[model samples]
Target: MKTVLVIEDDIGIQKQLKWSLTDYELVFAQDRSSALTQLRRYEPDVVTLDLGLPPDPANASEGLACLNDILSLQPECKVIVITGNTDNEHALKAIALGAYDYYQKPVDADVLNIIIARAFKISDLEAENRALKSANVGNTDIIGNSESILKAYRTVEKIAPTEITTLLLGESGTGKEVFARAIHRQSPRVNKPFVAINCASIPENLLESELFGYEKGAFTGANKTTLGKIECANGGTLLLDEIGDMPLSLQAKMLRFLQERVIERVGGRQELEVDVRVICATHRNLAEMVAEQSFREDLYYRISEITLNIPSLRQRGHDIVIIGKALLHKFNQEFNTQVQGFTDSAMQSMLHYAWPGNIRELQNKLKSAVILADSKYITEEDLGLSARNAKVDTLRKVREVAETQAIRHAYTLATGNLSKTADSLGITRPTLYALIDKYRLHDLRNTETEN
Candidate 1:
């Protein structure tokens, strides 16, 4: 339930306020000291405070101080100020001091409730907007179309229909979270939240509370009750990234959560049943970890009802050019720069280079080149890979890279008409056809023929 704090000193007013807001978990604090304690303890999302208090009942000073403290400590907290009918100026001052809204007395429960409800609605909308932005704003988050990635996507499509526990296997920076989201997007719980937490990022001691949450007084710093990533993702998807690094002790608890679909806060006895789909990703080899007795064997089997392995960019070959072009187009639209195309040297350089950092590194390199390249046609020098030689290149291989990129660039520049793509490259249509055949660039042909 949404929680609200009322910091009014008037006995009759407080009673009416609490009784009116029965839908919320309302907590009352009569004085500044108690109010601050409750503010820290409850961490209520919406708060109603009176400008008059015990120490300074005739003045708005104490109330303004409380507002500043609450705003400073919890910037996201929404504070509504209550003031006497004669204290209109003080109420306006409260608004200047970062108050969410002001209510002038005599207290009208209906009007106040409307304002409070609107504040909560605004809070929820902001949170939802942030999630939408993260999930859909940019392709930079993760990208793939190679068979390996496509295979993983297909697995996600199939597994998302069921509540089966899924394990994603890949090296770091392979966009494991991206694949996890695809599962969430395809799942029955698509409309719900998709919460993710990195197991390896948090400290071992803190990871438990972060995943399952903790009640007030659960730990030294457990000032307020919190819904952990798992609980927060209820009726949706919860992704545990880098689960291989999840401590062995917590592994048992995680197994129990998966088995029962329930979790207990760190120091709370009650079991909270959560209806969430669990998806986990890790770089470590679980089989190897199990063999070494570092990972729980039973837990491994539980989470791995299905597994998808995301391949590195090196394994995908010339798909790098396909992705690079896509990225170039993305940046071209975003930055509104007129980059005609990649130069011959840059195109071959991209084909021959080994992308050790996978697609992420490729993205970073392209973003850098996009910002730095002086010409409409970015060259090998702009990519900063001119010094890196291809590990092994046959004579036919060297010629093939130039011809393939030449055909692709020509096709793209011509908007994919084969005759135009061919003429633009200063080659006869038949010669271009042979080169296209030799290079196995079918997608380019599709576009060319379509145009």
Candidate 2:
């Protein structure tokens, strides 16, 4: 049986909870000392914490200290804090400090049970996704099954066989590197070394040497002869991440490399030919950079034989739930917790929220949620989105401000039949009727409908 550590000072409340969660091995610790002892001995996956411990029951310092100690010992432990009715602000602060879910007193087992279940599910999902315990570790595996991701997969499949220089465009944290790796994985050069270099990270002076490699004595601290990423990727592929920030001089050199398939090592006279496929990616708008003369237009034209745009998480339907489930599983294994899964509300929030930081942010937030969540299902609150005001306002369509191209999607998918377009949206046929009337799309529909 799983263990639950209850940290409330009230004896009556403790007895009630111990009876409520009798299925689990129940342990009680009213103060910091007993709590630490029970925590060390039992190592409970979920803790029902009362933020009013003795030595300062009226103040939150003792309880907060206990919370920190639990986290420090087992950062993945699920700690559901107990707070006052109007102490929601403190609960939010506790969440920010990595508390899973906080409850408002007086304590009610039914409500607390719900929170605990959600926490368990979240913990389970996270445990399922983590690869191993190590620093700088990443889940290099491509992690989406949405139509948008499927489209990306298809694009990679189509371009992988060819030697064309492909440009991947997307917002940061949208898994540009993952897509780049996917392309390499499916390419002809899979057996060869796949080298990746961040073009924008290295200094301009050092960037050249990092890519083209430097000959010994090429520059200060150029201690020994070294092969650059491009040469190292010979007969393979090189992913130029953040390619938009590369210097124009380097862009010119890169264009030459693409054309000649040869690179001159920095400060070296060797003109070595390489058989490496080039894949470039950036979150920046290259067209804007080109117009500003911050980037080489000619180089952009050369490298962009094919372009793949990765969709953001918000655009990927149902993928949020998929990735969340995957993440919950990862944390479950990592922390050895029994977190169940996401609550319906949590799932809805994941679907509706605009993921500004994309997958990376999802992992971090879920990691905290899984360890802190106390229930079998992770509620929206457990995911740090419980505030009623935090609920998202739905994305509304504004035809008046929309582009002709935007409405064209509705029209095309509707098969250019205005009547069908209105039916799909569940609005009154006349409401769709009015939109078609106002948008001047009726004429275009008739012409296309006839065809």
Candidate 3:
């Protein structure tokens, strides 16, 4: 059954509300302090507050204070305010201060019941939506249909349930962090905290304390002991973003935690054990960094128990169109625009132009286009994209470039083998040779000559 907290000071109205709101498991509080206590204790789904309480029953100040406190404690709770029939200003003030809805005094139990019912319905819908979002983390959130991206998602699906330390490797703005979250949601620790810390973003002097935490007096301003990201994520997952940029001095401490599953707080003697699954992500090549001795080889090996390489947006064919359309719809709602979709020219430019900043760049461009677009559809100019370089605009030229690109990619994968290239492209050897000749792919000829 849904819970409702009624905060009213008047005895007659409180009794009437109790009798009327029999549908809900109701809890009552007379004033601000008691209302907050009941709010924390019951954590009710809905709250009906009287905008007149003790010490200032004639005014709305005390009631408004209680409303703020209630929301601060439980932001999701729907607060409905009860105000005087003439108290239009206070009713408006209550709505502005985050009251879900308002009811004018001289209680009509039937009318108030309708409002409460609607509030509960809305709250239930929101809760269901949150659940759907959490459940769809594995499937719906990571949007891509290309072969390369499919392979990456497949890797995530396989490795997410395991306890192994997984490393996500990709270019900046690629969905490495998204995959990390997908892993966490799919894991047993979904209910536990998933703490993320970016090594590159934090100052070197503070990164250690942020990761491993510090005891009181660890530093000049340290007034109280604090739990670090790793400790906070105990029994869950901890994402070490930009792991390659982590300071060398802190790498040893991280290595110790990984090896021992334990951490020592700064200025503390006791070692605290943590059971967090470490997931590291970085755009930099850890192998090369290890070779150059800039990154610790042992730490690299420890974190890379399994490595999943997320493909760049440009590499994922047709996914650019898919993600662009999705972002367009999202931004349409966000910006309150009625933009239908991207223009044909816009789609062409998006396909042809290299998205160097990946999904982040695509999102920002779409958001700008939606906000600035005066027409029903978003144009390439609105998105700030240059004209599709002659290739994409002309169908024949596009096919030619696409065919040659496919042949080149397949040839490399097939190690310049004629039969293998033909099979990979699903073409006969003669057709492969014809296309290779048509494109003047002299690299294949050179490879054959060398062989």
Candidate 4:
């Protein structure tokens, strides 16, 4: 049964509500304190808040405070503020403060019932959507169909079973960790631990101990010996993330461990042998750092036996729209908004934006748009995009670019065969020739024709 909290101090009206709304599991509170208590206890999806409470029944201060508290505690709850007939100001204020909706005084049972039912319906739909997304989004599967991503996957398939140390280079927020996990999953040591540590996030002093462990008396706080990440990941894989930021003082020690396949604990003389496949990832250029003498060249050569360069979101053609659609589904389910998809202008803007943060930035933008959108389709304004001026003038230009991209994609898929390209694009050879001429796509047509 759906839960509803009715926060009205009037005892007579409470009894009437209980009798009328027998279909719902109702919880009632007469004051702000009790209402807050009930909110935490029941965790209702719908709240009927009255903007008048004891000690100041004529004023809305206490009720508004209760509303804020409820919203802060349960942001997804649909709060229907019940205000006096002349208290339109308070109603609007409540809405601005995040109340879902408001009802004027002299509440009819049927009208109130309809409002509460609608709220319940929306909440249930959002809950179902969230459940569905949680099943897929939490997995380590890298989601993209772009050619760059496919090539990266091919590299991963080739290198996963080997014991050589691999290096992954990418722009920040391009799902390097996800790729790392994919490698681990495909490796022979899939059942074993895949330990990961961000070299830059931890303090320099603590980093050595974190990677190589310590003896009981290594430091003042060391009460017992502990295994480090490399030791813990024995017989498995160890991912050293943001390896460019590893302290110079520790680089030689790390290089020694990499060369010898053994680690010496802090303040201990005995060296312990460990079997671990090391995978290093960094957004920074290690080659430049090596030339600058900030990064050890020997260490770079040791770690980068095989290298995979992850493509940025902007470089992955048509992936922006594909990922955007997936995100729209996810956020709509999360926020309980029925946002269908992006508008033509919004899609064009997304295609044009540099997306400095890559997939992470796109996800954030779509999330905000989903929450703020008041229409079925998300527009450029909803996406908070500033480039909304040249919609009509740029339509033809955008179409041409889109057509060119489509031809390129089809050509690549067809392996540059003219007949296959024509068949894939559902166009006659003559029409294909005309398009190729119009767009000057002769380079794509340089391949063999199926005579």
Instruction: Specify the highest-TM-score model's number.
Output: 3
Report backbone clashes per prediction: 0, 39, 0, 0
Write model 2 residue lDDT over 1-451, tens digit each, in one string: 5678889899998888877875677889989999999999887788988888899988788888999999998788899999989877767878887898888988677777788888876776565444222211123366666667777777887898888899999988888888888888887888998899999899998899899998999888889999999989998999999999898878889889888999999999989999999999999999999999999988889889999998888788777777777778789999888887787678877877788898887888799998898887788888876433345443333436463454566667888766665555556657765766676667754655632
Cα lDDT tens digits, model 4, 260-379, are 999998878998999998999999999999999999999999999999999999898667777788788878788888987778788888877788999999988999888888889899
In model 2, which runs have C-alpha deviations exceeding 4 angstroms?
A: 1-140, 386-451
Candidate models: Cα lDDT each:
0.83, 0.81, 0.88, 0.88
- In angstroms, the error of model 1 at 67 is 78
Clash list (residue pairs), candidate 4:
none
Number of the candidate with higher lDDT, 2 or 4: 4
Per-candidate alpha-carbon RMSD to the true structure: 27.2, 18.2, 23.8, 19.2
lDDT (Cα, 0-100) at 91 in candidate 3: 91
Could you tell me how far off, in angstroms, the CA of residue 49 lies in candidate 2 after the best superposition? 46
TM-score of 1: 0.55
Indicate the worst ten consecutive residues by lDDT in candidate 1: 131-140
TM-score of each: 0.55, 0.57, 0.59, 0.57
Model 3: colliding residue pairs: none
Tens digit per residue, CA lDDT, model 1, 1-451: 6889999888998788778887788999988889989999888889999988889999988889888888988888889998888888998999888888998988887898899999997776565444434433223344545566566666766787888888998877677888888778777898999999999999998999999999999989889999889999989999999999999999999999999999999899999899989898999999999999999999999999988888877776656766777678788888887776677678788878777777788889988889888988788888888735645575568888888777777787888789988778888889888888878887766665545
Shift of residue 376 alpha carbon in model 3, Å? 1.1
Model 4 CA deviation exceeding 4 Å by range: 1-140, 333-337, 387-451
For model 2, how many clashes? 39
